[model samples]
Target chain A: MNFNATLIGQMIAFVVFVWFCMKYVWPPMMKALDERKKTIADGLAAAERGQREHELAEERARESLVEAKQQAQEIISRAEKRAAEIVEEAKADARTEGERMIAAARNELDQELNRVKEELRGQVVSIAVAGAEKVLEREVNEQTHNELLTKLAAQI
Target chain B: MASDTLTSGEYIKHHLTNLTFGQHPDGSWGFAHTGEEAAQMGFWAIHVDSMFWSVLLGFILFYIFRKAAKNAHAGVPGGLQNFCEWIVDFINDTVRGSFSGRNPLIAPLAFTIFGWIFLMNFMDLIAVDLLPWLAQLFGQHVLGVDPHHVYFKVVPTTDPNITFGLALGVFILMLYYSIKMKGVGGFFGELAFQPFPKWMFPINLILEGVALIAKPVSLALRLFGNMYAGETIFILIALMYSAGIVMAGFGGLLQLGWAIFHILIITLQAFIFMTLTVVYLDMAHQEHH
Candidate 1:
């Protein structure tokens, strides 16, 4: 091809385009790309930190749940022990009261039996005195015989 | 295009020429009517089509980039932002890999070179005759200009001037960095005296001088040659359409295959140019050079 003024024109155009690109187009695009890279890196780092925190929170929750269950079991076992102790104490008190009531009933029955005996002796003495009176109407004084019969009843 | 009265040779020639506008032989300033007329205008003539297409493509590049830049954010990127960021990252990584110094301009320069050149070269994949044919039609109907005189080359990189223009800009930057980093004396010394004794300074001068100049020369030529050859092949393939229906279908298949292959070539050339620019600038920045 024949060389001409077009060479100079193309050169000028080349310079202008390169200058324009450097001044306007190149920097902004490069800045955007670099900024996006940094942003992505920061986002990824934040995501990693969040994951770590989530894992730690889960671990703490698990530990808290285990501890709470252990505490509930301990409280339930303590309550059961206390209930058993109360039941044993009540059984012991009921047994002692029942034995004391039986002893009082037996004493009352003995006192009743002694009283009946005394009455029977008195009746028997009266009958014997009557028979003696019939038999010994002619012998012995009446008042002295009655006094002896009373002393015999007291001895019975 | 095959239905035209032009022979295949003229068609190929038609595809290669640029729409030149300059002072004619009669001292009249206007568009060139032929390739010989364009040459007659000499170095003063401007290739209007290459300049027009490149500048338009550059503006388009700016529009998309500016839009993406405006909407770019630190959050998840939208589709356009994603695309823009992908290119930015690639250029950044490339500059980082090749450029050792911390010049803020290097990445953007590399980016511009890659993007601009890629867009320019991408013009090659468009049907070789499509835009030129449309341009010819416009010239004929609207401007009342002759269709034969409406020479337009769409792909700018195919022109040595355009590639050299880009290379010259990078070359200037390299020189600036060289002098800035190593001082003028050290830079000259690196060129005039190296890999030999003080007695061999003359030989060293020639050797080092050639090596130094070859950087930009090779850079410019490599891209120009590749693109020019590719365009020529495309034009040659297009000529097959004039032979017959069978030839036209074969030409279509060939054009498709070549275009698919050119996708790699275009991207590779752009990549190579960008990498070399960074490397050359890095060489400039090196104090031990």
Candidate 2:
């Protein structure tokens, strides 16, 4: 094999060129690719995060709606309870007023009966005095007639 | 009178010469002289033609790639961007797939190697005598250099040294990746213990040794043989025209067909080189043999 200066020079040039290209050119190219991959991955991650957040918000909204519905049901039931209470209070008041009216009527009847009884007594006594005058066909003493009329009135 | 009365062999040999200045006394190899070296003086000159065009083609491709990258799209690509994206994806999927380990440097190195060698191989499609003839005219008439001494060879692929040099670079890279991955001790241990126990170290060492040296040799010879054969055919056909063949039209058509066929050769050679490089690198990264 011939080994000359030119051959040596060619060998050196080849080694140098290959080494330089491998060191400088190849690295940046690979780095650019890695960066591109990272960018794509980041984009996907952001998209996934956004989707998760949206889903969470939707779930929260659904829960709030359910809670609102439950609250509305509770309020309606509370109003119903209030209405029933008002009805019950009205019924109790009506019962109390009826009993008071019945008592007043009873008292009024007793007073009327007493007045009627007193008038009747007065009439019976007059009648009895007239009867005694007739029976004797002549005048009698006042004390005797008065006593008879009182006894007749008591019996009636 | 002698100049005008030159035989066909002398003409062909004259045209076969390179744009070199100095000649070795033995007529095989020498350092290049400034202006008087024989056209085919040294092994290096054998590829001087290819070197010039290959570098030029590489720069042009680099420029194109840079421009595409500068204007790259994050979305739908168009024009050069589309082509570049396809090429990048192809290298990743194909070359990267062939290798065992994911090398960060291998892909781009493969790309440059493929493009450079393929471009050099493409020079084989040019008529074997075209560039030398052109060089002869320029050297004798324009540059005032003797046409005989003006040496240049446009096809670098036909030179074994250039291919071997390139293959050697890949070999060195393979070694580096192996060492880096396995450490020096581990690398040697692999050589001594691969495919058997430590007692069979001699056999393992021999196998590993053969495998290591064969890498560059196979790579160089594969490329050199293909391109040399292709150039030989072109030269023989060229001889037809110079032999006073009256049917130049038929010869021209045949040349065109051969050039078209050579395109496949060029592309295949480039692919093979890149794929092999990736495979070798992949092997280097493996912890086992």
Candidate 3:
């Protein structure tokens, strides 16, 4: 083939094709690819961030669970200590009441004994007066008799 | 020269020649009288068939790719969009691998060159007689012209003119980029210097100039040689049918074998052309230090 006007025509066609491709073909495709890459990167980053946040929330929940468990334990221990103190106070009150009642009963018994003894002494003095009267067979002075009886009672 | 009177040599020569339009030896403007006449007509003639087929294939490439580009989206791609994107990606990868320069034109240029030349060379796979036979029929019935004079060569890349034309454009771009990247003085300095001392400047100029010129020459010749040889083989296969039934059977087998192997040649030639172009441009863009 001769080197002729076909050379010029082919060159023109090449130039046109290259121009069209550069202007219309390459940029949009490259831009679309870049945008897709960016989108994928951003999506991965967001996923990672969400995972991190989920982990933090789980950690917080675990910490609160531990804190609640400690608080419940403290409450139970405090309640047990208060119950022991109340039982000790009730025991002390029962012992004091029993002692007081015993003392009162003892005092009542002593008073009763003293009364019996006094009554017995009074009856004995009366019997003695009666026997002396029968033997003497005469009336005696009342004031002198009373003084002797009281003195006898004191000796008894 | 009638079809029945033509010998095997004449038939093959006729099939190989382009439909040239230029100044006749009698100082007239018309179709060349013969293949020899066309060859002797020199630089002023145009190979009409090469130009027509080349431009037609180029338009086809542009229309399809442009449509794909127009409908392109960032979402899932359909068949046409997928094909277009595949081609773009292939060319982009080639350019990215070979070309280190920052110019945006290299990828598209490589794409255009590869696609256009591939389409042109693909015409070789068609039966050698098919288009010319069709043109003969059209010329005889529709145009009221002699059918025997209707010449058409389908494979444009088989023509050296078209291949050289493409290489010439790349060469010009190479020069432009070299000058732009290296400045005027540095461009000449590279051409005349290096791989040699400054004391041997004239020798360096000769050596580098020959090397520089050889780039485009080799690029053009490599493509043209492969395609032209392939086309000639197909023509020779077509020529075999006239010998005898046994010869025709052998030709058929040979045709199938060659066609299968030529497929690789066609694709490889296109790939080589594109790669060398990118490499040359890359060299031009390099700082000559």
Candidate 4:
């Protein structure tokens, strides 16, 4: 076949165009796609990491809450025990004070009763002596008076 | 115009020709004419019948698939589903056998190309004279373009420009895979060190470069030559009968047999083109020989 220059030029141009497409166009486009794939993967990984951190933080919060709850329970139990002790101490103090006040009142009443008994014994003896003096013009013997005084002391 | 002087066959032959540019006798760029012209666009040429038919068929297939998918069943498929699945499977298998790299794009592209080219090649089964004659009926009796001057070649693959253009597209794709698989430096190094030991780098480089050029040339020529030859034989056989020769009956029989034989040729040529495309892409995807 007789080759024409135009055909040769076209063939050349075709070769050049093929080369250009291979060299310039294809590589970059494929690379861009690969990069896009990698970007998506990385984004997913980052998202996963974020999710994991959030979960971890939540877990820690839950743990802290449990720890705080335990601590709060302990404090409440200790406070209750202390309150019980304070109530017991107050009750004991009130009981002791009441017993002391009753003992003091009994001692005061015993002293007053003793003084009244002595006054009454003295008055009875004086009244007996005045009666004997009016009844008897003459003086009585000491032995008879002693016997009556003893009997009166015994009776009082 | 002088076009009125030519027969239908000769008129058809002329339009089937190429418009050449550059290389004048005076040694400056001048215009000339060759039977091979680029399809009228930057990337597409006018000579390609396969491209046109393929695109049309692709759209048709796309519409059918969309409809089938829309009315799809979770149970056994309907008639359309079976047909669509069969084609999809065929295309997938072709891609699987041909391509090496895991490209989500190449499989569909190959399917589209295969379907389109097959449809275009199927156009050859139509009577060679049927469409052109029909056009003449409309032109001479109706629109009046002069039946004697009405010219059209319905078979696009019969045009060298079209076949060559398709081959060139495959060649471009091959180069793309090569570069993508291997970086620029790696790709150049491959050519520089191919088919020989590193000790023979200089000779290897030259040989490799020639081999690279030969790839597209052979690819284009093989397809163009087959389609062109098939069309020419059919036309010649038709002419023999139309000439009212003694061998007219024999010519008709021979033409019939040839047309039957040509079914294989057209199909084979399309398959070869597609197969080679896949092979080239596979080779490009390879990092080593």
Per-prediction TM-score, chain B alone: 0.98, 0.85, 0.96, 0.77
Candidate 3's residue-wise lDDT over B29-78, tens digit each? 88875777887778899999999999999889988988888887777778
Candidate 2 C-alpha lDDT tens digits along B68-176? 6666645545777767666766877777578766656677777777877887898888777767768768978998866655556777666665677678778888889
Model 2, which residues run further than 4 Å from truth? Answer: A1-156, B1-47
Which candidate comes out best when scored by DockQ? Answer: 1
> Could you estimate the TM-score for every candidate?
0.88, 0.63, 0.75, 0.54
- Candidate 2 lDDT over A30-102, as tens digits, reads 4455566778899999999999999999999999999999999999999999999999998988888888888
Pick by lDDT: which candidate is best?
1
DockQ for all candidate structures vs. native: 0.74, 0.06, 0.48, 0.01
By lDDT rank, best first, the candidates go: 1, 3, 2, 4
Report the C-alpha lDDT of model 3 over A36-112, residue by residue, as the tens digit: 66888898999999999999999999999999999999998998998898888888888888888988888888888
Tens digits of per-residue lDDT for model 4, A96-127: 99999999999999888988887887777666
Candidate 1, DockQ score (0 to 1): 0.74
User: How good is the docking of model 2, as DockQ?
Assistant: 0.06
Off by over 4 Å in 4: A1-156, B1-74, B141-143, B245-248
Report the lDDT tens digits of candidate 4 across residue range B149-251: 4444566555555556556666777788888889888888899886888888899889988887788788778876877777767766666655556667888
Q: Where's the lowest-lDDT run of ten residues in candidate 2 chain B?
A: B31-40
Query: Candidate 1, which CAPRI tier?
Result: medium
True contacts kept of 3: 0.80
Error of 1 at A143 (Å): 11
